[model samples]
Target: MVRKPVVSGMFYEDNADKLSSQIEDSFHSEFGPGKLPSKKRTREIFGVISPHAGYQFSGPGAAWAYREIAESRPADTYVMLGISHSGFPSCTSLEDWETPLGTVKVDKAFQAAFMERSGLKQDETAHSQEHSIEVQLPFLQFVNKEYKDQLKIAPIIISEEQRCKEIALSIAETIKQTGKKAVIIASSDFTHYGMNYGFFPFQDNVRENMHNLDKGAIEHIKSLDADKFMGYIDDTGATICGRLPVAAAISACRILGAKKAKMLQYYTSGDITHDYSSAVGYGSLVIE
Candidate 1:
């Protein structure tokens, strides 16, 4: 079965050629790596933390992460962890995903193994309307065009941060048993500020404070301290959308022998639109 794109035209270009061009533009945008990805791979990456927002707002951040992955060794599978804004319970979908560029296969064996090991429920309806995971596919297709047909993903929706470690360990175990070279991508957006989101800590210097808030959390992620990352979220009440997914990625990547992480990009929609009144922050990172 195949899951159609839920936010294709709304969040990004829906037409095939237009979508392809839009993705390329993102890679060359000012906030992006400022260049197209190369085939040379110097290091290995195990996980990625990407933002889920309209491509116009979050694409540049995602471009940075994808650029690194494009150059790194191509993995057979991408374990995608996303947050369903609909508040669905933590679950997995065994459905190939369709994008404007192409269809992404689902690693059914991997999904089955993970569900058995982690007890993550299988539900296609959970993924039917979520944009978090869908937005990343075209970018993946662009970067891995050489192996586009081989693109496969295991999509999981995370709803509880407390259960992140347990789920992550199960994912690590599944990967070990399957012997598939895999990369885990946790999609998230950081620090949703403004009264619109009902999260306002400071009255003055809103823009500066926003940067500081997101940077604090990024520091913990770079250090690979999942506890500290969760604590930072709690202590500050930062409205990060995919906190659970990121926490689980930290645990899984660490268990899989990833040493350190690099912050690919960090900026807010305000930076893009020049309107900080009601903007969400976006951050991109790679764990290696």
Candidate 2:
């Protein structure tokens, strides 16, 4: 079964040529303020954090991370931990995902091993309408175009924090046991502020406050402290949509012997729209 994209033409371009062009543009586009970390191609990246939003809004930020993955030469499979935006509970899908670029085959062998180790059930409906995972496919498609045949995906929907850690550990064990090289992609977006998300935590300096809050969370990620990352979100009531997914990826990376992380880029939607009244933050990071 092929899982058709639900967000194409809405969150990103639907036409194949247009989508490819848009992604290429994002790669060359100038990222927001602050000097981006220098891309080190020799270091092996264990995982990455990419934002899930409209391509125009967060594409440039995401490109920084994907560019690193492409430059480093990724493994055969990618374990994508995405938030359940469809309000569904946690689940995993074992179906090929169809994007405008092409169809990405699901790693059924890896999925089966993961399920046996993690005891997570396969629920196709859980991924039916979710946009978080769908939004990241184009980036992967563009980066792995040369090795598309070798690239397979294991898409998992993350919900609860504790459950995410447990599943992540299982994922690590499976990778170790199978001896299959895989990279984890944690699909997430930072703080969603203002009345739109009903998560306005500050009255003054909203933009700066949002950046600080997101930076604090990013620091935890940089340290590979999954517990501290989740705790920071709870303590500050930061409206990070994919906190669980990020925590899961961090924990998994830690188990996989990842010791360092670097922030690639950070920006908010407000920077583009010039409307600080309602904003959503986006960030990219690479864990190695």
Candidate 3:
């Protein structure tokens, strides 16, 4: 058995029934469940960008992607690549991530192959308390009920730009070799809007500016232009914490024949709290 849920009571409801209701409520409240578009409208998801903030702030944005993933034929595994805030040389850390819904077993066979091919060591410290990876679990549980029993996940915490690309490419290679349809999620929040994030150029206009930047970022992803993506961040100083993950996802998606990237939803914490002075950006995308 996998490790039990560690962040249920704190990050989300600890009670199973309450958690289920809340997750479903979140999905409907954020994006109307009744009006969910047909799966044919969106392309297959090779990778998606989700936020890592507390559920109160980013859960809705996270739900957009999770709901979409759930509607599609369920996958046998999920590969999550998250950002690392701790100071350390970049490496892909591994662990069996848990949630109150149930534990998502790690794919040991795939993990062993990934390590042998990528030369990245298995470091528990990378995932011990990283919120980026943990924040995506509840959405997974809500989207896939069989997650606990049938689905497995490979959790990798990335700390450096080069390492992020290396790991992403290695995983793409692994997927191709294994002939498995796996969903990859890159958890990150967009520009942190205020003095707290050190990116207050827009002042009260931060919210408007962030929406524009997010649009531009989504466009770059559509082109699968890694150089353009990195350049976009460099040029804007946009403050996206998942820069590497975004870039790598673009690269991997392009190789997989993803022709277009559609922005499913984009919003800031201010949308929820109405406090524009300081906020975080959240966006969800689907690559077809």
- Candidate 2 wrongly placed segments (more than 4 Å): 32-43
Instruction: Kindly indicate the candidate among 1 and 3 with the higher TM-score.
Output: 1
- Would you list the C-alpha lDDT of every candidate in the order shown? 0.91, 0.88, 0.72
- Give the alpha carbon lDDT tens digit for every residue of 1-288 in model 1: 789998999999999999988888888998988989988866689989998898999999999989988998889899999988998889999889999898999999999999999998988898999989999889989999999878899999989876789998999999998999999999999999998999888878878999999999999999888999999999999999999999999889999998888898999998888888898999999998
Stretches of candidate 1 exceeding 4 Å from the true structure:
none
Cα lDDT, model 2, residue 14: 97
Q: TM-score per candidate, in order?
A: 0.98, 0.95, 0.90
Better of 2 and 3 by lDDT: 2
* Candidate with best TM-score: 1
lDDT of 2 by residue, 1-288 (tens): 899999999999999999998887787776732233244445578989999999999889889878877777568789999988768878899999999999999999999999999888899999989998899888998888878887799999988766877888988998897788888999999999999899987889888898999999999999999889889988999998999988889899999999978998998999878888999999999999
Tens-place lDDT digits, model 3, residues 1-288: 344554667767888788777776666665323333244424356767777776766777777777678767666667777777775444554456677666677877777777777787776765775667787887887666654587777777666776666776887887787778877787878877788878877755666787888778778876778778778888988889987777767777777766767777888888777788888888887665
The lDDT, on a scale of 0 to 1, for candidate 2 is: 0.88
